[model samples]
Target: MKIKSLSLAIISATALLSGAVQAYETGDIIVRGGLASVNPDVDSGNIYAGGVEQADQRVDVNNDTQMGLSLTYMVQDNIGIELLAATPFSHNLQGKGGLAGLNDFAEVKHLPPTLTVQYYPMDNSSAFQPYVGVGLNYTIFFSEKFINGADATFGSLELDDSLGLAAQVGFDYEIAENWSLNAAVWYMDIDTTGTFKNANGTGDYKIDVSLDPWVYMAGVAYRF
Candidate 1:
């Protein structure tokens, strides 16, 4: 009877330890929240009027930071599907190249929601987990308006929505039974055409801008 009681005690202790350092398994859900920034690597095209492209006129875009959030569901031992979300990011539009003197031309808001299939290479029991993911990103641009000097010269403005591929790399360090620290970076391919109407009684003009941005995020995560 004493030997049986000792075995029971040992088993109970092992179970308690397992609970204290939780392992991510199938059906686990992780929710993370933190700060995220989007920095645009802009490649601006010449402004076009009618069928003619301008000589050297171009535009510039500035970066912004906002609260970011994400949700992940573990489908397999080392595979998870994650969705990244955030508050709308606002940026200032400026003139570049030939139009450098006309800076801060406009402001706009956008949201990028990305879905990725993440692969965790570290063992499930490991406290430090590193992951890589590839997925789709849908960026929606809105509230585009002309401002500063360009506002008086341009009547109205609109930007196109973008759908592109997104790639990510991140890690999570387990802090307790149900919480961890997380930091991630993503590269998104975003291309769009911005159209503007001239206030001087001319037709609509267009410019193709590739605002492919690198996104960085860091925060805390909780598992359920």
Candidate 2:
């Protein structure tokens, strides 16, 4: 009975040691998928119709959540190149301050694809990997349309695309040899100017929107 007990103990220790030696090596490719939430820290400009400014009438955006995917290729034991992608996110536009009483003005859809170089601080063999990244984000805006009869009043509306800087901090915890759970938070700098024509008259409306957003993602990752 004593010999059997000793064998079990040795087996458990060997399993632990094997897991500890598992490491992220050069030429490794990692794929991750999960939910990503984007919340804009907005700074909107007052509305101007026909070049006439409307006092305190600003534009704001709501938050959205969508499926997020990321692909990473290790260049070294501690460095990697990552590309982040996701499905389109839709946001409802709102009027704020003096225009706060107005109904929803419009809705817009966008896709932000980011590329970054990440630095992992922990040892490659460690199960818990924490990383920091900095790179660029290009946001493409589409399917912008007015709602609640605003289309009839505002005519056609258009929002410009944006290219900006992005940064993030994240961590990964290995649950098995090739599987890890990950969580990350990123800050993005996004800005755009929008224009619309007033159908009721000959005036053109304009607004400068700054949608600096914080994005959060939580999901599982698999190494290849």
Backbone clashes in model 2, listed as residue pairs:
none
lDDT of 2 by residue, 124-145 (tens): 8788899999999999999988
lDDT of 1 by residue, 156-202 (tens): 68899999999999999999888999999999999999988887757
The 10 consecutive residues of candidate 2 with the worst lDDT sum are 16-25
TM-score for each of the candidates: 0.91, 0.91
Q: Which residue window of length 10 is worst by lDDT in model 1?
A: 15-24
**Clashing residue pairs in candidate 1, if any?**
none
Off by over 4 Å in 1: 1-18
lDDT against the true structure, each candidate: 0.92, 0.92
Which regions of candidate 2 deviate over 4 angstroms?
A: 1-16, 19-21
| TM-score, prediction 1 | 0.91
